[model samples]
Target: MKWLNKNRVLKVIFFALVVKPLVFIILGLNVRGKNNLPTKGPAIIAANHNSHLDTLVLMSLYPLSLLYKIRPVAAADYFLSNKYRAWFALNIIGIIPIERQRRVRKTELFSGCHTALDNDEILIIFPEGSRGQPEQISRIKKGLYHIVHDRKKTAIIPVLMHGLGKALPKGEALLVPFNCDVVIAPEMAEFQTADDFVKQLESCYQELKTYCITTTEQHN
Candidate 1:
């Protein structure tokens, strides 16, 4: 039973594919731009983090089999433990441990990420190193830039989650029952050293934000 306590992937899969979608159906969760998702190999998706619900929404939109290839990079300190949630987080979704509190070799992460890209897998990255307050985003780190910059061959997609912050705020376990939006968009690419890289990166967030606003307007 020791190991059982550490493995929750099966349950998570059920929840993500079954229970959560059912919840969305019953509650009518709004998600758009799924067609923007690359249908084939080796891509990177960068998104903002607002709630635990963010991962579920993103993964659900990705095709089922590719779900197997998607690895979510999460904070090591928060998700690493002897507990079942920790085990599933580490083994199931393939966690990339990020030591935010300490200054570590940044290149190590890039090497691992590069290897994953070369393997033609999808990686989900939260640019905000730390989850921020409602309607707010933490300063995005360079990890995303480094990964996409180095692996130019891989498709890089920008995603934005809307209204999830109000549904579930930071530092709170209460997941309020409410509808949210997942805005998917086209692949954005630029040269590594291009001066427009910064604008391109910010453009991803801006597009997501715009999608959210437009969705809100349409619904109303």
Candidate 2:
């Protein structure tokens, strides 16, 4: 399927992004606490990966038109596994692929990312570089810092996806019907040092954990 068709994207979104969310809600899925989305300008979206579904779910959370503008940062190897991912990354998600093996692909991806910035696009990055449990957010790599440090112009927006880990946990292709929440917090200030950025990244997870707890408390 063509990932992005100016005319068809709206229709595709209707089915995939919109209808699915409504279905999710009918099945008891809803996003709570998106007051966290940055109000303006390009920002870095740093999130924890719990399942293969996390990225798509996150994209769905974005208001219809804005979804296409949010480019996902994905691994070249995985997203390029087939025509589907390649197109998904290129057209639908706008992924910047990084070579897992060496710096060659990394440099190319980094350069492409820089160009995306030139176009004023927001980027989504999974600091861990792969999927894992919500608790593993702290195990994040320094690549996040490298991206932010290089493009010091953008803000880093911390987002927490609640209930998604359980919705489609690793190794499961089927998405479990459940209520999901995407909590967004405002963009963070630039880090003073590389160490400081890592600290802040870890802190984002802590804050997300707090949000999850509070949400549970409210519902209970």
Which residues of candidate 2, in runs, are more than 4 Å off? Answer: 1-33, 105-107, 213-220
Q: How much does candidate 2 score in TM-score? A: 0.80
Q: What is the C-alpha lDDT profile of model 1 across 164-210, one tens digit per residue?
A: 77666678887666677677778886655634565676767876776
Candidate 2 lDDT, tens digit per residue, 57-128?
666666665655677788888878899768756765667777776656545647766766676777788887
Error of 1 at 120 (Å): 0.9
The global Cα lDDT (0 to 1) of model 1 is 0.69
Listed per model in order, the count of residue pairs whose N, CA or C atoms clash below 3 Å is 2, 3
Question: What's the lDDT for candidate 2?
Answer: 0.67
Query: Clashing residue pairs in candidate 2, if any?
Result: 29-179, 36-184, 36-185
Q: List ranges where model 1 is wrong by over 4 Å.
A: 1-19, 213-220
Clashing pairs in 1: 5-84, 6-84
RMSD of 2: 4.5
lDDT values, one for every candidate: 0.69, 0.67
